[model samples]
Every structure is written in C-alpha cells, then in structure tokens.
Target chain A: MSLPTLLEVVNLKKTFVRRSGSFLKPKKTDVYAVNNVSFSIEKGEILGIIGESGCGKTTTVRMIMRLMNESNGKILFNGQNLCGLSDEKTTKVRKDMQMIFQDPYDTLNPGMRIVDILMEPLHAHKPNMTKEEKYQKVKETTEAIELIPAEDFLNRFPHQLSGGQRQRIAIARAVILEPSFIAADEPTSMLDVSVRAGILNLLLDLREKMGLTMLFITHDLSTASYMCDRIAVMYQGSIVEIGETQKIIDFPTHPYTKALVSVVKDLNSFIENRETMILDGEVDSTKKTLGCAFVSRCPHQEAVCHNVVPSLEQIDKVQSVACHCFGSSKMGISERSGALV
Target chain B: MGKTVLSVENLSTFYKTDKGISRAVENVSFTVEEGEILGLIGESGCGKSTVAQSILRLIEYPGKVVKGKVFLHEKELISASEADLYDIRWSEISVIPQSAMNALNPVHRIGEQIMEAILIHEHVSKKEALDRTKVLLELVGIDRERWKSYPHEFSGGMKQRVAIAMALACYPKMIISDESTTGLDVLTQSQVIALLKDLQRKMNLSIILISHDLPMVTSISDKIAIMYAGKLVEWASTDDILHDARHPYSRALLDATPDLINRDKKIVSIPGTVPNLVNIKSCCRFHTRCPFAFERCKVEEPELKEVKPGHFAACFLEEENHELTYTS
Candidate 1:
C-alpha cells in the first residue's frame, strides 16, 4: 500500500463526434468513449480495470499507450505529462510503457518468424547493438516464456504454434524491452482455461522477477480477483467502484458492482442457492445522459439517481463507491439487507 | 423415467487438412434425456463444437463423421440421407449458434427470419406463421414490438433472444446451444442463462449446452461432459464433476478456474499444450500435460469407465485409486 506511484491517469477523456443528418447541414453528436476517468498505479502493483464491452476500458488503455490521443486530461508517467510530449520524446518513453493486446493472432504478424518478431523491439530501441546481443535477448526471452529449447521455435511462424504458445510469444515480445509498466487488455480472454492459467502464473512470476507494474483489463470478475491487487469496476466510461480485489468481491458497495458480483457464477454454489440478480438492460455507452449512467438498470434507483451524477466517495480506507444509495434507505432490497447480499 | 431425447455413441469425426487428417472428435458419446440439460464442456479447439455439429450432421466438406450412431429418440441421424435429414433438422433437433449477433440476417426483419424458419420446417399459413413468430419472441422474453426491427437495430442480448426464438420456432425436442452465451457481457450472459432456464422449465425442452466456461456451465447444467483433444474425458452430474472430478484434465481445468468466492485457493494451470490433432497417437491425449501421468499412459489410451454409480472418467489413476495427487 505504501508503494510509490508509477503511472497516474488524471481525468483522461476521449470523445468521438459523429456527423449525422443531411450532408448540407449535418449535426454532430459527441460519443463519450472515455469520460473523466482517473486512477494511479504503483510500482509492482497489478491494478485491474475491469468492465464489460464498450465501457471505455479499451479507450482508457489506448489513451495511456498514446495509440489514440485524448480529447482532455493528462497521463503522468513518473510525474511527466505524456500527452504533451513531442513525437520523438514519446517514442523514447514508449519503451518504458508497452501494451499487450487481447487477440494474440491479430497482434502478431503471421508472415514473420518468432525470432524476428521478438527482435524488432531490440532493433528499434537499441539499433547499434550487435546481432549477437539481439539474438541472445531473443533466446533468453523465449526460454523465459517457457518456449524451451528456444531453437525449436526460433525459425517457426505463428501459424505453426498453438494458441497457448502464440500467447506466450506475445508475452515475450511485450516484456523483451523490460518495460516499467504494462497495459494488458484481456490478454487471456481468447485463451483456454489451462492456457489462461499458465499465462496468469507467468505474469505473476514476471512481475516478481522483473519488478513490473501492470494494468490488467478484463470483464471476468474471477480473473480480476485472482490476478489483481486492486480492481476498478468501470461502467459507461466511468469507474463506479474501486477497492481491494477481495473487498470488492466480499463487500461490493455500488449497485452495479453488486449486480456484477452476483452474476458471477460461483463454482462451489449449488444451483438452488445460485442468486439470480438480473439487470434490466444493456450498457448504453453512446448516450449523453445528465444523471448516473446505471440508473436505467439499477435495482435501487430513485428520483435523485435519474437527475444527479454521483461522484466517488470513500467508504473505508481502501474502498470507494460512486453510488447515492450506498448507505441510505433508498435501496430496494425489500426483504434482505443491502450489506453484502 | 424420462425418455432419451438424444443419444450419441462412439462418434468419431475427422477433418482432412492439407497436412493430414485432424481428429476433431474421436470416439465421443453422451445422452440428453427429456427435460434434461447436458453441458458439453471443453477449452477452445477441444472439439466440443464439432461434437454438436456432428450430431446434427452439420460438418462441412473437409470434416466427415467417419463412424458414429447419433440417435434422436428412436431415429438414426447419421444414416439419414440429405432429404431425410432436412426434414428432421429444425423440427426435431435445432441449434442455437454460438455467435447470436451474427446469426441473424442483418437485412431481414427479426419476425421474417423466425417466420422463414417455421415455414421451411412446417406447413403453416403466413398468418399463422406471423402469429407464431410473435409468440416465439414473447417466449424468449423479447418484446413483440421489436419483431419488425432489423438485427442491427436490436441489442446483443435481444439478438441472442431472437436466435433462441428461431431455434424454438418448430418446438424441437432437443436444442444444441453452442456457446450461446460466449460473447455476451456478464450481466447479459446471466440474463440469457436465466431466460434459457425459464424456457426449459415452461416448455420441458431438452438442451445440450456447449461452452468452454466450466463455472457458467455448472450453473444451469444437470449433467456435465468434459472434452479434451477431441475425446470425452469425464461425464457426471454437475455437483459430482465440480466437486470430485476424476480425470486429470478435468481436475486441472477446475483448478485453473478462478472462483469468485474461493479467493484463497491458488490456481494451478496445467503445463504444456494440447497434443497435435493430426494423426494423434494417444494412449491418453492429456498424458503430456497431466501431472499424475505414469508409464502406462504412454502405452495405452484409457477408456472412459464408471468410477462411481453414475460418474465416469478416462484415467488410469482414477481406475486405481479414484483420486489425483497434486505435487510438483
């Protein structure tokens, strides 16, 4: 908890304006892809940005990686504004901040061999290095990712590898530069259970061995609980809840977070005891609403919820929730109490 | 006793690729009784989908069902000709495809698609078909007003509901839901699961639910069948499979799954990858990755045998002691 901050995202926002109506006189409506999101990651800490699709988790990571420019706010890496840096300077800083995408097949080039793919980062960052140095780095990294007898896979293309091995190569490519921070957006969602398990263990091992900080983004709460030190539950381009992983799982505060947690299928729970907490509707990410975004689907919604935006309030030392009815009588839990249902 | 709605025995399917024949589904078998939900579980590329496709004779050119007997009630599906199979499909055994969002025709109205499906299978009038389409939409919990809406106009969950409605248009005795909730969000996935459960109860429909998610499958499935590398590794009740899985692959998959409640248990991902399917020589396919694999696993493939009264597993260790030891 006392670790120093490695990356700080301050109110990062990205808006996409689409032109509609007639061509002569078009009307532009702004889609708030990512709006007013703020969080900080400490060194060696795995902070999960958990949310369903189109909740701006991807946009948030994209802006931090500087793949897409933000419309507003700042991303501070070591107390420096990353958004305003020059092209050359940003390219230099990119080595310290790398990203691992969700689909390993799409991220990797099928035409290139595994060796060349892993060596591209080295050649780009340290172009003056000898061929022996680049080859040595690739060999070490390939072995580190458990592609043992690195010679077996060095000359092979991605199509020749399995899903698990392809993902391992992706991890090797991401960490070959030894970035200080990594933004892994659903790195294992496309993988199988056993493969995901291996990748999760490898990431934990890499964090310990390399002292790496991470922002692991996923929609699965169980994965977040297993891998993250702290999780930030996002809804409609905003984080509705943020806390320690276990605390959020055990004592979920926000209504949306409660719905999400309840919906997660517990392996040990019997079917008869399986709680059915259904939300009324899907996420409306394109809407420019004046009130809380989850109001339409929240079971505890009231008149005030439809008119006012709720800011995050600290409930405890490590837990924070952005809900107006967190500790109030407005909750619609008729029979059971609102505490950790 | 409930009647056997669908029974598959000794089913083997192969895909002829340029390199070699890929053993996609080899000697897999299971049964779905009337009003029962059987979950076919496995990781991606483990041939769970192929099993479903093979049962319906839906495999394409390269993929052929070399040997098997797929019985829907008393009728044999594997031996049925194209014309006979056409008459049986959608009327007797329907399928809810994995990607519901892409299943529906983007240009056609939801009602039209459902009506088309009904008209093709049954001899119903246009007015009756339209009325039945409305009923189908209502049965899946989708509003009847949205029947005229195009697939793109509806939400992802709504599209999935439409797919379910299409599957239920002819009231098939058994429905093969191929990863029906795969691409949906958590809340939507739960909603879809709930809707499927509700439909099953109201209509007494038999379902063969296929998914890679163990926990999600356990939620609604009465029986669970685990597949690995195109073979059936374990088959038992949901409780038994979740609590006392005998096969090393099933146990490893269970251990690899991160539980929402049990946060303290360490997840143990099985090392090594699935064996190559091209001309796969197996005593046990999972022998390379299995921690408890011994000398016998290399020489002979273990057949799935009864470990308990109703539970079955294909493991030599289970045959000996009925338990797997977890040691590094």
Candidate 2:
C-alpha cells in the first residue's frame, strides 16, 4: 500500500529583488530563485531534489523549514499550513523537522564540546529534564550514530574529530530530538569518497531507525539514484522532471534530465559514448522568462518552446515531465525512450 | 605507454604542526608517461594533493619535502635551484590548480592574464602574446570576443575554460590538474573533462588528473593510482584497477561509490576514520578499518607488490595465484 503523504509543497515560489546598476540609476528586478516548485514526501519515503548550483534546491528546503519566508504558495506539513503559523507555533512544528547542512565544519560551532553541541536541542526542548535523564538520552543517540564509546568523544571539541566524525556528530545532533522529517542539503558533498559513503549509509540507517521522511538535496545524479526512491530534477528554479529513480535514469524525458543522465561519468559508458551528448551554456537564473528556461541550451528546442512556458505534466503513471516537445516531435518521448532499450 | 615524462621516487613530504610532525606524503613513488593521463584517486587527507604539491615543489612554510627525487623527463628537479625551477614551472610543466575556476584575477581582463602568463615564460612581444592568447582561448572552445571581460563577467564553465586556456598558453609537456572539476555541475564537469581529453590528444600533453571522484578520473585516465593515508596502495591500468582490484582499501572505495546500473548492490562504508598523520604507526594504515585485516596487518606494513602482470596492490591478502581472501 502507498504511504500517506507527510509533507506536501504546493506552488512554492521565492523571488529576490536585485537592486543594481549603480546607486545613481538603481534598477530593481525580481529574480525568481524558485518559481512554482512543488513536490510531496510520504512518511518514511526519501525524495531527492537533484539540480545544479543556483537551481533553487537550497532555497526550496529553506522555505519548507520556514527558516526563510516564501514569496508565495503553501507548505503543508501533515495537513497543516506551515507558512500561516505564528512564530511560536512554527518553532514547535520545526522540532519534528530537522536540517543537515552541506558543510559539517562550518555548521558546527568551534568552541563547544561535543556534549554541549548535541545537548543544546535537548536543553531548549526539555528545559525541566533531570541531568541524569539528559545524559542517558544523549548517550543513546551517540551510540545510535555508531560513535563508539560515546564517553571518549563527549568531552572532545569538533576540531578534535575528523571530517567524517564531525559529520556523524552533526547527524547525531539532528536525530537527538528524534525528528520525523529531515532535510539534508548535500550532506556528503564536502567529504571524501570513503567518508561520504559512511555519511550516506548513516543517513540511510537513521531513516530506517527513526522512521524519517527525508528530502535529500544534491547535484549528483549517481548518489541521488542510489539513495532516493523518487528523484525530482530541478532546473532554473523549476522541477523539469520527477519520477521513480530507476525510470528517470533509464528513460529521461526532459531535455535537461536527459543531458544530466548522459553526463553522469559512468566508467563503462566512457569508451562507447565518449562524445554522446553535452548541454551547451551554463544555467542563467537571472532572466525573466515567459517560456522554458532551458531553451537557450536545449538541443531539441522548437520555436514554440521559447514562447510558451511548460508546466509539469504527467507522461505516465510513474513519470512526469515539464517539456512541450517531450512527445511532440521525432526527437520526442518515444524516440528518446527507445534509446534506453 | 609512451616515454616516462615524469618520475617521482621515494618522495616524502612532512608538515611541522604545533602538536607533532605530520607526514602528509610518505615515500610515494609513481611515473607519468608522455601523452598519457595518470589519475590519482584518494579520499580527503590521504595526501593526494600533497603528492602533487611535492612534485611541483610548491610546499610552503612548515612543510617540506624531507627526502626524495622528482625528475622531469630525466632532469632532477628537487636539487634544481629556485631560479631554474621558475623556468620549468610554466614552460615545461604547467598547473591548472584545483581552484582555478575562480583563480583568475578579478581586477584584470581575461586576455591580459593569459597574455601575461605567456610573456612571463617566453620572450614574446605584447602583440604576439595577445594573439597567442586568442588562439589558446579558441582552442579551448571559448569565445575570443569575451577576452576583454573580467573573471566575474564569465560563468563558472567559462571561467574553467579560460583556466584551461591559460594552462595551454605555454604548451607545457605536462599539466597537473588538481581537482579541476570538484565544484562544477555534472554537465559542466563532463564538458571540461571532454575538453581536457581533446586537448591531451591534440597537443600530446601528459596530465596528472588528481581528484576524489574516482569514476570521473577513471573515465579519462590511462592508469589509476589509489592513495590512502599518505601512501600509494594500488596502481594499475584503469580497466584492471576498476575490474580486478586487489587492495582492500581500493575494493572498499569502489564499493563505497554508489553504482548506477547495479541497484541491488548496497554501499559498504569503510568503518573508522583515517589514521592521524602525526607519528603514524608501522603497521598497515588501512588495517584498522579493513574487514579482512589479519594479525600480520596489525604488526607490519605491506609494500606494493605486483600481484598481476600490470596491476600492483599493497596488501597481505593477495596470494601467488592472485586470489583475494577478502569477500566484499
């Protein structure tokens, strides 16, 4: 049976006003950092938001966490509109939802010991708890993350620990309160491959142990495919594609998604498909567009693609795409899907 | 493989920190052939960058290459004077630093930077240098019209292209690309990798592509060298290393990377953190986390031995028949 949706984001939008062109002739333009982005996460499901830099993946998560105000749309968590809640109410709601940042070194405080760092949440949430009770809870959480002999690391500072250990501590802090929903923004991007593997596996373990509904944000398709149950491809502040992980990688429909899949650095495909495909130009999120944002770099762009904006539409039961030319031309959905076979 | 363009032997570099001496690169030895790409794959703090820096003789204060020899094609570079090294820096061996994407001077024009680099190594006139800069830009598939633009004016991909262009200005025999595509998006990374491969073939230039992204490195490198805890644990042809890895660390690293095609394969993490570099023990560095580590692994270090015809692995598990006892 399909799980009930725990978090649903509807028509989310965020815009930053750019006041530039010198102080003499100041120009104000609205840059749509996130435009009408929407997705849902089921309880105990891992939904990965994959994209390049400045694609509004971070901004979307920030809005969902209510760390920053969204310019428009709804953030519904367990059927409650989080955007409409008061500061105190939102703060209470935030306890069940935690965030893991990209860089562990930067996110953690340098001066605090490991115990103090992990205890801040407990102290804030349970102000009247006994010292013995807090210590037992902290010890259990540390052991859960496999930080062996919790007593050894409890007194040490963040700097005393390695990059991998620091990240584990960060995860420990996040799950200390036993949050139901977790948003990890490139949690392992800054770590080494071996260390990254540990962190990724830790996240997976924590999800199973805590029954977490996770939103994983990353630019890496390979990692996303490995970890995520459903993958959402974001581009220029919009989700160009979203589907089952395997289906998306095997038969990508959107031009951007197809290009992303092709460039994944698969060692086996290197010789045969050395020069297979490459999307031209960089992502420009500054432009105010009435049409598709990927038109400038897309190889399958038609005349109509430049003038008409394509909303995400379902192509099948398991897949959806936001492209007008997806099933329209010879380079359409059928032809592209044929490539997979 | 072509003629060995660069050979490093017993290269040991150390950093004198307040706590103790940290051996960042220890007795590392490897060879890079002309017109070949040698991939250096390692985790962070594994001395991958240290090895690269020691070769270029770029280690700063509190860090020194205590012992070793670096030969650029047959000439010894370690004993060479700083003045002589300057001549070989850009002309003989150039470097496209890891952070080169944003390494461009924000104040100066892109064309001027490339031109200045050319003029520094070669006694070319201002006009000739400028003309050569345009050609270099074009060679890297960058628009020559944007030569007058500043670094910030260009995109991340464009900045990377300009960096590659600058690296090519001197037509060095060898180029050291240290984590060139680390922060780039996948699409841009592929483009850059393709550009580097194309340039390597066209110019017959040797490259040492150092990166933590193993698959990306394996895609272009003719040979791969795996480093762990400031030591070379494995070295073999890209295909051999990828398919028939012998070192436990290498196997763990391969397993750690999530497979794209094989969905059922679970990612097995190497337990424990990297050993502290300060006053490192004599035993195998990876033994602490290696699943198959035996009693011998705890007491003695294993040297890199040729387990197969072309593949070498530093491990005690490999028998004479090339059978590994460690099961994944």
What TM value does the first chain of each candidate achieve?
0.94, 0.95
Scored against the native two-chain complex, candidate 2 gets a DockQ of: 0.62
lDDT of 2 by residue, B161-239 (tens): 8998998888999999989888888888888888898889889999999999887888789999999999999999999
- Superposed model 1: Cα runs more than 4 Å off: A265-276, A330-340, B321-323
Best by lDDT: 1
Stretches > 4 Å off in candidate 2 = A127-129, A265-276, A338-341, B319-323
Chain A agreement with the truth for model 1, given as TM-score: 0.94
- Per-candidate Cα RMSD to the true structure, in Å, reads 2.5, 2.2
Worst 10 residues of 1 chain A by lDDT: A267-276
